[model samples]
Target chain A: MYVRAHTWWTILRIALEERLVYRGDFALGTLMRFLPIITQIFLWWAIFESIGSGSVETAEIANFTFPDMVAYYLLTMVGRAFSSMPGLASGVARQIRDGEIKKFLIQPVDMVGFLMLNRIAHKLAYYSVAILPFALVFYLCRGYFTAGWPDPLTLAAFVSSLILGFLLGFFLETSIGLIGFWFLEVSSLLFVYMLFSFFLSGHMFPLDLLPEPWNLLVDLLPLKYMAYFPAAVFLGKVSQDELMLQLGIQVAWIVFFIFLSRYLWKRGVSRYSGFGG
Target chain B: MSEQQPVLVRVFLTFARNSLVREMTFRTNFFIQCVSAISWTLMNLGFYLIIFHHLNRKPLADGSGWQQNEFFVFLATTWIVFSIVQAFFMPNVQEFSELIRTGNLDFVFLKPIDTQFLISFAKVDWSALANFVMGILLLTVGVWRLTTQSNNPLSLNLANVLLYWFYVACGVTILYSLMISLAATSIWLGRNQSLYDFWFYITNFSRYPMEIYARSWGWSLWGLFTFVIPILIVINVPARILARPLRPEGPWLGLPLSGFAILATLVCLVISRRVFSLALQSYRSASS
Candidate 1:
């Protein structure tokens, strides 16, 4: 167990260094990415004005003000910053397709263990550089957070949810990549998964605002934990007990996905063919 | 060069046909690609549907008196413009870095063809045309709903339809120019991994109505994106002409700006062409 732990630590350290090598490019890219929020901010402003923003009683949309909506969108960006594993799945699929999986077979590495450790390293490296841009942008738009900061407990829950969200994302994506073992290509499947996740994960809007059946159905899914629930927790939407319950649910889903990925990897390796010898 | 126009046309058709054939080899993959594009468009449609449902057709102040259907028209125009670019230029521009890395550009230079034209048109993503179909469908439905649902619908005339298509063409040209110039930068950068990221940043500004950005806070964005990049005029002009004509606030600017957009598109194309040539000149082959 100690040897195993040491091996994974080495992998994480190397991955972290590799990511830091492109620190400038990563930071610039992260900053450029927030540009889309400008359109969202404007669109919500128009919506709120059109619906009448005179007062809480007079406004047509009662639940969400323009500032609230903007804050939600910006906070969702933070959630995505934690949860999005940009090219992990596709990278895995490509490696499998090109017979590059042979390296793991020849070496003393476990696929999922190596991938999870590498992703942890990647996240650490990302947050190191990315926090600057995110902080700068969020500071500029600080006025949107009309509700102000959350209570201490809620803040802690929000941070915990983000960390778990990253784990869930990595496992879910790597499981999807494991499909490449049976299929010649997985890009199409990955595309479908991405499209569904983009909507159902509440990246587009608050899931509560979605229609009845959809809201209920999306609540049952694990995706919202990655985006909506964390932001909602910070907004004080979820109660203290509910926050604990949701975090438990989030951990349960992560465990289930991790096991699923391991099961798939085991089954895949039994029939694997490395063509290049 | 004038005498070679027919040959160029023939070569383009051939390239497109070969690309289709190659893509068809992976039948399921091709089908999945189309389905994927359509699904995202549908999701966007659903998202706006819900937002508009919340609005209940009230006119937005910053939306320039736009209601549900008028905004749908704008959204449809965005998809159409984006799909045209995706079909024609996206795949080629995406592969520019790969061409440079693998030294395949040597073969491109040796061909008896205009390097820019050949590189841009050599690959056609036929599945991306699915979004074009979806866009047209949405636009037709939005226009129909606007005429029927609104109390004072904009006049739908032959002039508007023709002008709408003209502006769409101009919009596409401007977008294509922007993409080609960005792709050219890969020669200097060796590999621009964030090309898609930057592309989204630039294009996101054009997705909404220009009116939203005419405010005090958005004036800089308006000036920067409208006159400098000229992306705002791309979708806004066509959607405006067709969806809700001139709305009195900027009637003179509306008609005159479409003309300027055409001039802008031409200027952008010329500039991007020059940039591509300059980049090509500076490119050292892999042997170096």
Candidate 2:
């Protein structure tokens, strides 16, 4: 137990140091992240205003009018802050591929602690600098910040769901990156993974807007937890019961991917040629 | 004249041929990448379709009198121009900044040709050839669906279309210039990757329909285009070629487009040569 606690402390220290080294990058990335959310919000607002006459009211797809879309996509921004884990996946892969992780293996550090700390550090910096301001501006503009907060139990469930959501996301991406060991190139594989994420993860637009079976089919995947369901929770759309159900599902998927990643990493390292020479 | 042009042609063709041969060893990988590129276009097309269906008979984002299909076609054409740049011009210059950092640039300088041309044309991604072909096919479909807005396909007539190709060629040159200039970072302080990231994300500015706006904002982007980032010219010039007024009160827009394309190309070539020489001077060779 003492050894594990020491490992965790070491990882946290390194992660904190990493953030300091790339302070400018984090700041710039945070600013850029706002652009997409703002662009999507304004563009969607214009689209709905023009098409809906004032707002879409067909009772189709959750009665999402022009204004509701603004609110919905804002939720998208906040959830994205919580669930997006691109750095952890790519960072770990590069470390392994470059054999930089050898330094850690020779030390007394825990692998999970290091990975989680790296993720936590980036998110802490990014969320504080960028996403929080974005969430505030969006809330003040739309009046959803206070009005949209569900009851305490519901809000608590929402936050709990997001933790599981992030875990599943990290697992999914890291497992794919782990393939870099056996495969000569994981760049193309990562691109393919991004393609799926863009569509299925509700990154661009929600899956519900698509055809019938697709909306239903997407729920079977953990992607809905990544962007869509979390957004729904933030909007006060889901009930406590549904939130609990989805949270359970997210946890199950996370465990499955974690196990899969461990298996792949072990099998892969056995084949690693230490191509450094 | 024939001797000069033939040598250039032989160089480009040989580069293309050898890259194709090298890529064939991993043909399955190449095929998936091509399909991946195609799928990207399809996803964008899908989003536009969803919007188009929602916006039937509606005015545009700015309360302008533009039809959805008109803006859609404009966006589609811009995307096609984007694909051409990504496929034809980007690979060489895109690799440049990273190459400089790793000292892999020595191999490029050792090549027996104009270092500018060779470095700007190296690393021909064979998969991108299919991407180019696929883009034109998507553009054709986009134009055909554009039948909703125009009973006459006269806008796509061959003579006018050839002029548009000239504009696209101009756009490619400017893209190379901008990329190579950014790549010249190896000369100053070796700051390529971060610079490339800035360039990569800036391409988002062009992904939208230009007809919806006058591209006056983008014209100022020209300052950034010629000097800071070349992708601005690559995206905007092509749109300028195809940007039709919603009402068509103007006599001709295509002429100005041809002129701009030529101007941008000349600027690209000149700037590129200067940048290359500076990079060469800065080179502390591997032996050093």
Give the alpha-carbon lDDT of every model. Answer: 0.85, 0.65
Question: Per-residue lDDT for A215-272 in model 1, tens only?
Answer: 8889789999878888888888788878888899999999999999989888988888
In candidate 1, stretches whose alpha carbon ends up further than 4 angstroms from where it belongs are: A53-62, A91-109, A269-276, B1-4, B60-63, B245-253
True contacts kept of each: 0.80, 0.33
DockQ of 1: 0.62
Clashing pairs in 2: none
Docking class of 1: medium
TM-score of candidate 1 to 2 decimals:
0.92
C-alpha lDDT (0 to 100) for residue B82 of candidate 1: 96
The best candidate in terms of TM-score: 1
Instruction: Please give the distance, in angstroms, between residue B81's alpha carbon in candidate 2 and its true position after superposition.
Output: 2.5
Residue B235 alpha-carbon offset, candidate 2, angstroms: 4.6
